[model samples]
Target chain A: MDALLIDPVLARACGSALAVILLLGAWQKLRDMAVFEAAVELYRLLPDRMVPLFARALPMLEAAAGAALLLESTRGIGLVLALVVLGISTGGVLINLLRGHTDIDCGCGGADGNTRLSWALPVRNAVLMLLAVAGAQAGLARPLVWVDFITVAGGTLALLGIYAAGNQLLANHPRLMQLRNGS
Target chain B: MNEALMISNALLWVAVLAALIGLFALARQIGVLYERVAPMGALMIDTGPKVGEPAPSFELPTLTGNARVRIGGAADKSTLLFFLSPTCPVCKKLLPILRSVNETERSWLRVVLASDGEQPEHLAFYEKADLKPFPYLLSQDLGIGFHVGKLPYAVLMDEQGRITAKGLVNSREQLESLFTAKELGVASVQDFIDHQHDHQRA
Candidate 1:
């Protein structure tokens, strides 16, 4: 466990990345509440009466977790909140996938809100959960330096870029398969 | 030595960040290219009025106005009958594209909106969609005549009432391909590709 501790700078970078992702997810959901509500209804996990309420509350929770993650004092609670949210979402995806309801939208909004349900989504969520866990670990305290700031900023941006590229690839996967089958 | 190492580390971080940004941009471009190339052309269902055949003519009433709209006949400009519905989201999305096409192709093309629905519902949709410029026709016979099974289908008819090309179009590029098919003298882009392959094989 001691050997698994992340460097403070790297941990900060991870937290910041997760925070930005959560905030963006919340913003996307809030931007189109109706669409998000429809997606939640499609999940079939919540009762019809609860769908709208859950849909409305999820983004608020995500925003709260994301804001909490930004502050060092509240990062622990934020990580827990993020993990719970990710777990529930992944569970919903897993249930739907198992049910063979792959036609519904994933609702992981970005440029690719229309991406269908697939195994890749759970894997993506797992990766995010790993980031949350890694971000939760405390690292050895070290004196701050200007170079450290550059590394942290650069690292976070790179992580975000990689995340975006991965999402684009995920979005393209089904279309590529369709093309391959000559459909 | 410590100072020099820090400088090199910072420089390496900057380079990595630049490389990641470049990678992301390349990925985005690839995504766009996939979208552009995926739908080779509007999906030709093969059940509709065949290309190069004369379309069944219809004198339908405009939904918004009292004027009668002629669907197929000898005309100066080509007619593009865009079959759409008030409830179909994809059809709604294509309205803006249809509007732009109407504007750009005004010289040689007359775009008409077609659907089968009740008067009050369609009239409300027409007003809300701001479709006053294009003649909106509510005719079930028109849809059946064309064998349109999908929402947001398009049929392009030349001045002589011949359907030059027609198919299920979901995007702007797919819609434009109907015009391209007309220009190429091919039934559809799929036919154009098959022709190319045959030529190469020969």
Candidate 2:
């Protein structure tokens, strides 16, 4: 079952998709460090002493991991770091959800950082982590071909478009609920 | 027979690729809908007075001394009631912006600053912030009436005292969104965008 799921071609496509998403997220944090810091503060999961340092370092770490994921030699280390980072963020979202702090920004970037926490966020992270693990475990089955590259490109674009759509829907959920409740 | 099989395989790949493109297009359409429906302007909590309803009336003492001010229910000017605090850094930052907004539309708009805190601290804020141009009212009752749970909140009321728009405003853009919503006769910017999208589709 595991071997069936960890197909090398699928793994490469997942790696590319995950790298693009993480790189975009990291770039947004780097673009506006202050906004990212404010979002971290809202989570209230980090100590005051650690918040500034973590805020400064997290984007750099994500960007490095994303870049490394695209390279053949560093792909292993990149997968490990991607899993760790995705786990930490999933933990953050899960903690905030449990605490009933639903209004804070997810800091995921894009759509003006307006994306709020929802059940979808942690689920999305979990899905990415699974993809990262599959990519890390994938073994070469055969030589590459032009058709294989085309498949990877199409698959990655499809995955990313769906991901973007999901994030936007999560952001819209609260407003739609409000509109429904007539408040 | 072999050539026919190869042609069939190529056709299958083309069909799959077309299906992927169709799925992607559908996802992008949903994204556009989300973008139009979500409130990117201001973070509005659900506890507040509902937009389009009459604002809860309050007669509170103004900081300018001796004269009590009445809010809500049929006024000469539309009210831009802002809830702020002396301690909130964001609220303090917004004072100048609010002052300019007050100055620019002095005729049709009545910008009233409301807060619930110690009198002396507010007095100091009033003096140091140079908020003499606006009516700064110190009233917990007004804040409670509006169900303002956060600092730097704003509510726009029409001349008939109907709540046009209200939300937790952080930036000047968000503050301006309130006015924009009012001008467009929508409850919020999200609604305005959705309305426009529906019109376009129609």
Candidate 1 residue runs with Cα over 4 Å from true position: A1-4, B40-202
| Reference-based TM-score of each model | 0.62, 0.60
- Give the clash total for candidate 1: 0
Residue pairs in clash, model 2: none
Winner by lDDT: 1
Against the true structure, candidate 2 reaches a TM-score of 0.60
Please write out the lDDT profile of model 2 over residues B1-202, one tens digit for every residue: 9769666766766676677667656655665554343322223433657999999998888886867787999999999999876545457557778888887777678999988767886898788668887888987678767877556789999999999999989888999889877879966788879856654454
Instruction: Pick out the ten consecutive residues of candidate 1 chain B with the lowest summed lDDT.
Output: B37-46
Indicate the docking level reached by candidate 2: incorrect
Q: Which candidate has the top score in TM-score?
A: 1
The runs of at least 3 residues in candidate 2 whose Cα sits more than 4 Å from the true structure, single-residue gaps closed, are A1-3, B1-202
